[model samples]
Target: MSNTQGPVLVIGATGRQGFATATSLLEKGWPVRAFVRDPAAPKARELRSAGAELAVGDLDDEDSLRPAMEGVHGIFLMLTMMEGVHITAKGIADEERRGKTVAELAAKAGVAHLVYTSLQGVHQDSGVEYYDAKEHIEDHIRALGLPATILRPVLFMDNFATYNRPTRDGDNLVLALAVLPHLPMPLIAIQDIGRFAALAFERPAEFLGRDLVIAGDLLTPPQIAEILARTAGLTPRSVQVPVEQISAFDEQVGKMFAFFNSRPTPPIDITALRTTLPDLMTLEDWLRATDWQA
Candidate 1:
């Protein structure tokens, strides 16, 4: 490791955000240690191939994190909700506990800086159990007395490629939510979240104690449909998916849309963010870059 680039531990390294963050740091010439549940997993093997040191650990056991945290330059803490999209009360509790444990462990380990990837623009409760858990963890991290940067990312464009696929084959992708196509919800590429995380660690003085709301471009469902049409070469329709099918996940997402609909838009200044991370991805940029499969 270079003198400036010490070991940085990345929590949830096997997952989307964590893996991207770790990869970003590695590309920046930082020695990266990936903290994952099973170091032998395929993604873990890939992380190792990409020049990240593997540290086996789980959020449920903070002691497992101690070795990963020991004498680290910084820590990228991306804690999972511990289960599916439809979060429960127990799931919320687990997330909060796990995040707090990471913060406490990082503080105890005497880590230089800690960056937490959190959600943005959520009101009290926000009708989403997971968002509430993130809010709690954010508060806990702030109170930890550790030098920390809280990067609050809006909706991830990666969701479109992964869980929120617009069309299956040639079928019109219908999305059911409380808000209409015109209602703007801040969105970013999950890869951009990683890019921002790396930059935050690199420049602690500017980012420390700051809550950055990150967004690449503001687009609604209909607008997103256009992107899908352009990419997929098929006209996509925007109808709300059935709420009854997904239950709380749908209800919570509906509330999120409603919250976005009623409130002033979040200040995720793209122009300002571009000064540091000039390559921060826009929706079009993401669409062009992604190899969208049917």
Candidate 2:
């Protein structure tokens, strides 16, 4: 079969990173199989319109995943954590179960490569449910001896446009979050991640069995505020709330901020990733390019 004839099975293909990866693969002349919950959903239809073959399957069902993996050349795996929802014990268990199921099935199906998207700075005793669950899944994938490349992404630039974007207070752009304004945080565009995943599959000799922490830019909260302010024609103000206040809202998210705040500087060398994936966006560049109303 030609490299373009692949059956690259992209789990979570309806969502952000998965969609980006699937789109990138298509752009690179590779056939993509998108495994999604509801093929009738609009986003799934969008994938189909974009030329990805749809495979209806639930992440929680290993049996469903089996058929989806048939004749697959590669796999893009991610756990579907409910963003902005309160993390419950059951949610954490479900994430682990679903993530581990995908990993095991990929191995059983003899997938050539499995790309797992996980969080950066995962610690075993991090006391954060989501991050630790990813760590557990990573350990399991490693234990299975599957040829895997783990992509650890930082804070997404998309969050600035959607979930955590700046709010306008009078003439000022107010960014209210849990961490200090000066804490350097790594960030990336989902498209960049997709590009890297596609390149990894194409160059398996260089990427297989690697754990690459990928980011496009590193900027602090206040720096981000200034960029948005510059782009949107407003004064910038940052409200770094107490961890407790954030915890009252979201314990998991609050702990994540505490982790970010405690670490003065982001440890990831984004430059290290530029060799393979270049033209990363800065905060100013991203804000200028985005349409807030969209």
Candidate 3:
């Protein structure tokens, strides 16, 4: 274990990626400063108990961010999209502007390493709002000449956990709106991404100025369904829904499917990542390790 000592500021610390990265950094003896919108939030308090210094900051408020970035060695920026039932185009623009502002601030603050969590297939000409928003941030990061590392992670396997049940209409696990039945898309667990981010902060020299597409494993929808069934001890079936059915599906789920089906994006190069961290977990391994019954 390398003895790296410096305060790393994590944005959106209450969220999945932020929480995981903060926990990982603390476990590895790194001083973590979490930029949370509400320090009194349950998650923020939990992070405080786990040895993280919480700083009140919102991505939209530039004034609030300076305090968090001051004297930080590195920053982990993961901008979350709006999950509201109804959001306007103006809302999206505001979110993207805030994210870009944060990147610019991190650069101006002279943070040694800026690790940004981006979405996969964003570089494609898909013109999806969510992906395009991320690309806007990435472009700003590159143009700013910051010592940055951008990580584009695929759909999280844990997305399955959000569905009500394994099957919709009796044993049929609804694979809604996904056109690529046999396409082996890449994915990484939240925990693994956290670990990878921590490692990147530690090895800034190697990772700086790199755009890494990261994934633990590549599996098709059917294969994923089989793995889920095997892990949960049930015979799950797979059903493919058309792209047009996306809007009718749960709005968020629909957007996710549309993103996945836009292109047959290839898996990321994990060779450098593997060299640094060999204990990365695959989907099967994660299922085995997780307490499904709980």
Top TM-score model:
2
List TM-score per model, in order.
0.90, 0.94, 0.90
Which order, best to worst by lDDT?
2, 1, 3
Candidate 2 lDDT by residue in tens digits, 65-102: 89999999999987756744677667878889888988
Candidate 2 global TM-score:
0.94
Give per-candidate clash totals.
Answer: 5, 0, 0
lDDT of 3 by residue, 2-87 (tens): 33545999998998899989999999889999999888999999999999999997777789999889989899988766656443
Better of 1 and 2 by TM-score: 2
The parts of candidate 3 lying over 4 Å away from their true place are 1-5, 85-88, 163-165, 168-177, 249-259, 270-272
Worst ten-residue run, lDDT, model 1? 170-179
Candidate 3: pairs in clash: none
The per-model lDDT (C-alpha) reads 0.79, 0.82, 0.77
